[model samples]
Target: MASEGAEYDRTRGAGDTAEATGEGGRETAAPPDPKIAAAVAAAEAAGPQHGETVRIDSWIWSVRLVKTRSLGATACRGGHVRVNGERVKPAHSVRVGDEVRLRHEGRERVVVVKRLIRKRVGAPVAAQCYID
Candidate 1:
């Protein structure tokens, strides 16, 4: 019985360490993709320090509200997207605090722009750019 308990303790300790280091006992924070990094850098350079305005379609894509910029633009042109209760074109400017309503995939998603990001990013990063 003592041997079994010792084995259990070792297994639990190993599991904890594995989780800390990520799967396969390796750290997970790999370097950012070069393309993504470049895009983000360009976006940051073109806009103000923060709270800058961006095109509606670009904002939607950047926030991961749509899968792609073309899809976002299509929704805007199809009248499936509105800003502050008024229909807007894809080229319309979206600023911080603006309310956006997008109808897609048989559902409506309403979001408020909290921060503007012009480049596409991972889902976790994109989620930080808006308020639902």
Candidate 2:
């Protein structure tokens, strides 16, 4: 699962490298791109990718998980959702890779983000947008 420009985890034992996980688990020593590093630093400095907090209505709402952002917002307002392990309002901001925990109707769901947008995208697109 090798991809270009992936960072290796140096903490692993030497032979563990061959297990060869990519991206989150990549084991190869790859150099960081200066340009990318600069851009990432700038984004971080500007704020958390999507900002410290973002309104649910402004995001590509995860409908299936909790129904419309409005519903999600309602749930959030009612303290049904948590961002980074803390309960937040429906308007609490989210960004790429943000971990979300959703509780609804006695069931709990956990998801990790793979993308973020400011519009209502279709189901397939929304699915692609998350990595739960």
Per-residue CA lDDT of model 2 for 1-132, tens digit only, reads 353223344434444754544542422232254544444344335433434454653452643565576777788888878878998876676777778887888998788866555545445445555777
Q: How far in Å is the alpha carbon of 108 misplaced in model 2? A: 1.1
The residue ranges of model 2 lying beyond 4 angstroms of the native Cα positions read 1-54, 57-63
* Candidate 1 lDDT for residue 56: 97
Best by the TM-score measure: 1
TM-scores, in order shown?
Answer: 0.64, 0.53
lDDT of 1 by residue, 76-127 (tens): 9999999999999999999888999999999999999877777777765566
Structure candidate 2, residue pairs in collision: 53-93, 54-93
The lDDT values for all models are 0.82, 0.60
Clashes of each: 0, 2
